[model samples]
Target: MSPATAVVLCALAWTVFLGAHLALNGRWWPWLAVSLLPPPLFAAAPLALLLAAAASGSVPGAVLAAGCLLAGWRQSGVNSRAVRRSSPERAGIRVVSWNTQHWNQGREPDRFYAFLHSLPADIYLLQEYLNGFEGGEVWDIDDEERLRREFPGHHLSVDNNSVTLSRFPPAGPPVPVGACSLRVDVRTPDGILSTYNVHIPVQLTVMNPLSRAFFQDMRRRHGARRREYDALVADLLANPHPFLVSGDFNTSAAIGDIRRMPRAAHDAIGANRSLFPASWHARWRLRLWRIDWVFTSAGVRAEQYTFRDPGGLSDHLAQDVTITTTAIEEMNR
Candidate 1:
């Protein structure tokens, strides 16, 4: 094929991607697809260069490249100022949330133990941590006993897929909110701090092959997740203390409902950091996406945020957010 023909083909493909990016961020329902397949927009620069090289006066290609550039910047969170390395005073609380990929036995126990020891978070919220407990809906006592003996003084979900490990003991037993959400308040210097760690079901897949069943599945999953979001938010909001709702939402911030946190909570990473931190890997560190999140109340300010090793043990990346509520207390003082 001629270089011009190749450039023409690349330009067409780039145009389609550019259009998809623009359409995906729209408030309309179709934009939901963008939330799932966000990484494709990154191809804009290379394609634009190819187009420009093949044809010096390629107006359509130029426009497509420009749009792609704009979208890429926004998606990359270039303007995000939410993440930092350390807290303003280093006295803020550090919270870590990771989907530990079921903490499969013997998968990466040595590394996992090292991670647990090295994590600086005062509070740890882990999802998909399993202990091989499966028998007639009964939690395996052996598994539960092992974790209790190893990591005692924490409220854990044996049946569900989430766990909350705090430096301080829970004020009381964990209160069940719903399917995979539990609330546990801890005593802090400022006051009581409540955390609702949830594991929501996965959202509609955009990468799936396009078919009638795809649309139906998307709608079904979206509807179910929407209800769960509403319910989880309501339950968390009704509780006492300045709270944070965190864990894997399985939905990207590109979705309206996903962006709408319970009680107007702020996304610690999204608000403070401007860089796109994809938190999940599909196959062998490929197909990355940010489905895990941490949301804090207005009173709690996230001073810093960072992602754990992407290619680490779990398919999901760990989210470490160092936050301070001292600002609120200081203001009150």
Candidate 2:
């Protein structure tokens, strides 16, 4: 065979093999195929490649290396100016919402606690809190005590499922909207701030047949969980107060119903941020979804919002936000 022909054949064969490898496993080989994927797919591939390159150095890998460094900056645990002065008396109250994946049972609890320790929020809303009593056992008093110690001088309430810790005293009794929601008022320098900690039922339509069947049964038994969420939202809107609501609603902010909840009441993380990794295993990977949220009334304005990375503990990343409300009104000419 001619040398020119031999070189061309070898190049073609190598290209085909690399393409197949990427199609099968995306972590490394996919970087080569990135140019061939759809635009959006190609955009997100760089992040994966960056993470891979950071873990394993390679030539022509400087782009991924830089991306990894940039993404890591947001998760470095450095408190922003807003986060540092979040006290009610100084800066406006800061509220944070996070789904801790049963408080990081898959890893050490300290990792989760360390993340929480970095923030000085007046009110904290946490979802996926395990009570350890689902099997008809005693309550987890030790876990409760630890939380109390962590946030000293805060009014605390635990619903055996979700928990709310605050620096201000409770303004009213704990009002339960559902098994997953708790509403209360806490005092702030401006006045009382009404807040809700919610954890909505997860969407089951995307799981396996058996899992889907179980979720369907749950829906039938519960009689439309979305309606319950709607009712809670309606009640909050009707009430007159500076409202702040946060939790894992198990739905995206772009949904029609969610969007209708007054743009004033919007997630700090915005409607476009993806809180969960799109792929777990190769076959189970799917499109990005935003299930967690933090919303406020007209009086509050979100100054900054961020989605934290997995500190190697929970399945979902933590979302931290800083909000401000000014008494001045805008005038039209």
Candidate 3:
């Protein structure tokens, strides 16, 4: 094929690929298209297309590459090349949200727990945080008696699939509602901090099954998750305290309007306008999707946002967030 023709095909291919991510969800044919394209192909196809086209001496290749890069950069949301760092302007409260995938005491227990202890976070809220309290005893890190020895005096609540470990006491116990959400209010020196930790499972077992039943189930899961998000937003609105909602959203942040994530809250990750740090796997261990998220309400803003490397145990990368009191007067109240 002529270089010109090849470049044109390449541009069209990249355009279609980008369009698919923006438009498709777990429905029918589009679902297949979106899911079938593996994460590697999703990330690399456009780059490959651009390079092959540029080598072909086709001017269109440059234009297509520019468009492709621009689109990607926008989706990435990163403004500056340098990652933002913690600042004193922030309220001196460091919060880390992680979906530990229940591996705080797995193969690398020492490393995991050590890393956990090292974070300077005043609070650590986790999803998929499991520590059974069956025998009239509360346990963390696999119920080791040492937990009491190690954490001493630090407040911890590990109930439901969601957990919160903080320096100060939360106003009450976690409120679990809908299918997979936990709400809590932390009484910080600044004010009451309303926080919600949500986990929206993607129904992986039925997502790709050939049976029509599974296909229908996939759609229902989407509908159900949508409702859960709506209800969570409503709850966040009713909260009297300064608030933030962080979670394993399951769906991509690029689908913002569909998720209808709170307009009043600033999506901390997006608000930082930082680089795309994939929170989920693409292959044996490749990071590809930034599904884990953090959002803060009007009076609060993130001073810095950073993530841990994907620990071998969990599919998610832990997010360390430093939030500031944008409205000092409100926080004083």
Candidate 3, residues 49-157, lDDT tens digits: the string is: 6777778877787677667766654344333444555345535678888877664634566676676777757777777655432222334444434444556655666
Q: Residue 227, candidate 2: how far off, in angstroms?
A: 3.5
Q: Write the per-residue lDDT of candidate 1 for residues 1-333, one digit (tens) a residue.
A: 655545556766766765665555424444555566555345535455545744766555565566565655544423245444433545588888887765654566556766765775678887765544321132222255555565665545443556777876677777766666667787766777788777776655555547886777666666667667777877756654677777888765444556446545776764435355677772355545677778877677776767777345777777888777643431211
TM-score of each: 0.70, 0.60, 0.72
* Residue 150 displacement in candidate 2 (angstroms): 1.5
Once superposed on the true structure, which residue ranges of model 3 sit more than 4 Å away at CA? Answer: 26-91, 103-115, 131-152, 206-217, 252-259, 270-276, 281-286, 309-313, 327-333
Every candidate's lDDT: 0.63, 0.56, 0.64
Ordered list by lDDT, greatest first: 3, 1, 2
Candidate 2: regions farther than 4 A off: 1-91, 131-142, 205-207, 210-215, 218-222, 253-264, 267-287, 326-333
- How well does candidate 3 score on lDDT at residue 88? 50
**Which stretches of candidate 1 lie above 4 Å from their native place?**
1-34, 39-79, 82-89, 105-111, 131-142, 153-159, 204-213, 270-274, 282-287, 310-312, 327-333
lDDT head-to-head 2 vs 3, winner: 3
lDDT of 1: 0.63
Better of 1 and 3 by TM-score: 3
lDDT tens readout by residue for model 2, 1-333:
654444334334434533453344212222222222322332334454545444554433535334433433332212234334333433556777777666755567777788887776777888777733221342332477788777887788777367788888888877776667888877666676778887776433334636656545545423444555676767676667677787776544212234335545754543223333221112222434445667877667666666655554555656666767645332111
